[model samples]
Target: MSRTIKHEEKYQQFTIELDGDEAELAYACPSEDVVDFTHTYVPKSERGNGMAESLIEEGLKYAREHNLKVKATCPAVAKYINAHPEYKDLLAHP
Candidate 1:
């Protein structure tokens, strides 16, 4: 399946549309230079298609482009970051 992801900056979300359903990676700005990835959701039928991974990747890309650090409050996001070391530098400094 083909998926197109969109970043809705106003909503602080990265979303993907699939068969009329929407999956999203939602975030909040805890500080001017920090993005907290709070949640990610994909409909049951849409799961296992790499939707969540795509959303996380897109969110990370946005963080990088804006020179923002990331706080992965969501387990899935943290897991993704752990698996992808290239994004580790984006993690917010403690």
Candidate 2:
């Protein structure tokens, strides 16, 4: 099943929804050239289940599809990119 990414403005957070519950939350700082993902975390119950990686992976797919560059400031996002070399092209200044 496909998950959805939802932005909750009141909470100032982005959530990756898996079947309705939040799998992960992502916070980003946007800029003219790139979007810096400042924080990304999954609930303790969801950890070790690849939920966070799923969100980051889909987020990267969205960025590349929209021609956006990524500046992953969030340690989770940064590590995701490093491990997934295929996403390197979407990195800012890459």
Candidate 3:
């Protein structure tokens, strides 16, 4: 199914509406050019549909477009980054 991911800059999160529920990926910018991916939440009924991954992909695309680096603090974000080496160059290391 096609879902639209909305970037809520004021809330520092990306959200997707699915079947009357919302899935979100929260992030924080600790610096001018760094975004820390802090949390990912998908409703139990919405799980296993790759919504979280879609959220991350949208977040990463935003980061790249804005020339910001990413700090994968959320486990799901970290795992996605690990599995997708193409995004490694965008990582912000300590």
**Best candidate, TM-score-wise?**
3
Estimate the overall C-alpha local distance difference test score of candidate 2: 0.73
| Candidate 1 displacement at residue 8 in angstroms | 0.9
Q: How well is each residue in 1-94 modelled by candidate 2, as lDDT tens digits? A: 4556776646645677654456654556466556667777776766887778877877777678778798887889999999989999889873
Worst 10 residues of 2 by lDDT: 18-27
Pairwise lDDT winner, candidates 1 and 2 = 1
Error of 3 at 12 (Å): 0.4
| Residue-wise C-alpha lDDT for candidate 1, range 5-94, written one tens digit per residue | 988989989999777889999999999999999999999988898999999999999999999999999999999999999999999988
Please give the TM-score that candidate 3 achieves against the real structure. 0.96
Q: Output the TM-score of candidate 2.
A: 0.74
Worst 10 residues of 1 by lDDT: 12-21
Score each candidate by Cα lDDT: 0.95, 0.73, 0.96
TM-score of 1: 0.95
Q: What does candidate 3's lDDT look like per residue over 9-58, in tens digits?
A: 99999999777889999999999999999999999998999999999999
